[model samples]
Target chain A: MDENPATAPLPANGPLDGDPGLQPERTALAWGRTLLTLIAASAMSLRWLPDQGPFVLAMFGLTIAAGSGIYLTQRRRYRRSVEGIRAGRLAPDAAAVFWTAGACVALGAVGVWLVLS
Target chain B: MTVPSTSTPPPGSVPRRSRFAEKILPGGTEPDPRFTLANERTFLAWIRTSLALLAGGIAVEAFTTDVFPEPVRRGLSVLLLLLGMLLSAGSAIRWLRVESSLRSNRPLPLPLIGPLLAAGCAVAAAVVIAVVVLG
Candidate 1:
């Protein structure tokens, strides 16, 4: 009962009570930039439509889907980050990062195949 | 307000860590949020680099139809696309390694991307130069 209220923990549901670094906001923006890049790549894939046929179209669709997924989840991630900081705990999004990496590798391999054939 | 807090936590209180976090990054005290965010940004930057490289590959294939011979064109395109693939995979692995290191309080691992990308780009340049000179 003698604990200093000033040094006590903030309420769990309190508004973003810590992290002045704006790290979460910056991270969210970084993800947004990544989504933008993916969309640009999708658009670029369309340039190969006439020659590469439907394969490039499929790639474009996939890229768009991935981009959309990122856009949709960004808000949740941002909120979680804010809460995480306040709670003094945060988990990295490993699955998303790995999946994105996997998609890039697949796209690269497909690109190689398309060019060779 | 977004004031930075270096405030000491009350004794006997445990930070609320998630089970998933424990599974992925099992130990060590949580590092500063700033560092984690920075690491995430670095990973995203690498992903962008991969996409840019893939775009370059596709551009070469799509636009260089008449400028270079078929064999050279295909080879160069393949090289670039492969580089993109390598970098994407490398970046993902690097992110995990770094995150784990951060969690464990170990020194971060050295990135092999700089050397690898440099060598690959040099080779690509050499190939292009040879084609331009000989063709």
Candidate 2:
């Protein structure tokens, strides 16, 4: 039986032997889409806040800016990873764990508050 | 114990180390895919949590009457929104870090934000409770 390209391993230092453009682009798009969603959600929250309009707007703006920065950074990171794989020198990122754990704790706190309050 | 000898390779004949496995698990070894997938899932869960926080902030600001002053409401909303954004952004960053770490065969990074977040939440919760009790 022929092996599935999606599951089959490509030789190191070759073109990304599977979906290639489609898969990487899809992953990148997923990141972009999530960022945009979070940005829109933040805007909605900002809009709802009363009186401190300018402050809220500023915070939202900052959040959007941060999101954009993160998005661009992820793009670069992924691109580098892809290139590394093609070049047979893939390197793992070091900061990803802290960021994920931090976000989890923050969100968990929010969840706790929402449930208790 | 009985010894039997067969020279045939296993049926599914995966190479000693495949390229995809190497990318997924660098260092010329295979780690569990489940771990990687779980990490990704956790990150997504955090993003969802961020969204929920944003929703809660909006709800608080939009609903509720003079039970809380407008300024307080706005403050809470901004806090929640900011938290959401931070959490989402942080989660993505962490995911990347973890993924890379797994590839490079390093110990997972220690979690520093957890304590800070917990303290912040405790303070925020206490304030909310005080408002509820005093108002």
Candidate 3:
């Protein structure tokens, strides 16, 4: 049987479905805080790169990429979260957490290297 | 694709989507998704702490390059940077543990790394205090 497929409601729970929770927005804001913290740290470390060359520049690039990644993903995350909330199935975002945490470790390693050499 | 309606549903079998996330949080769906968000925020907070320590290391090295004995100054900076690395790496483990526990309906695990990080920061501070006092 052939059926028309254009009339289904979008997969979203109504605004009141979850009782006024702002968890997705708060999670995004928490990421914003993490991004700000990382940017500040990158700026702080930039002082030492006056003569240290490309290794340091790479650190700057790392943090910038991390910032831009989180920035770009924010809208997508927020939108997908609405659908997830509506459907009651929000999975943990372990890879995003892993990457952000990896950036921190890389930045810390760069910091240590800058101090030592 | 319809999932079987067991009381405990298995995680999706699509490992190709994310190898990194495949086992990070095991033990079925979280009972409440809000707690998962809280866990993510806490992980972010730990990362912020890591960044703060990294900045502190840079600040000490940049500002005090010659004010103290070279070894002492470099040592403090190194210590802070090391602490930052530990915090950064540990945050993910902490997040996974909490998420797993939340999913399994268990009490949260004891904060095995949090107090150690605090103590490490204290030691770094005491070193600076010792330097300022002795000279």
Compared with the true structure, what per-residue lDDT tens digits does model 2 show for residues B1-135? 011112323433422334443444445322333344445555656666667666666666656555677667766766765666566667666666666676567888765445545665676678679778887
- Order of candidates by TM-score, top first? 3, 1, 2
Tens-digit per-residue lDDT, B53-111, candidate 1: 88888888888888999888888888889998999999988987888888778999999
What is the Cα-based TM-score of model 2? Answer: 0.47
Interface RMSD of candidate 2? 11.5
lDDT of 1 by residue, A1-117 (tens): 534333345567955546767788989999999989877865766777888878988888888888889999999888767755654545677778887888888888878887777
Highest-DockQ candidate: 1
Give each model's whole-structure lDDT: 0.79, 0.52, 0.77
- On residues A17-101, what C-alpha lDDT tens digit does candidate 3 reach at each position? 3526687898889988888889889888777777786877888988999999999999977765554454445667888988998
> Per-residue lDDT tens digits of candidate 2, residues A5-60?
22345548845522233434444555565567656655654443465566556656
Q: Is candidate 2 or candidate 3 better by DockQ?
A: 3
- Candidate ranking under DockQ, highest first, comes to 1, 3, 2
Candidate with more favorable, higher TM-score: 1 or 3: 3
Overlapping backbone residue pairs in candidate 1 total: 0
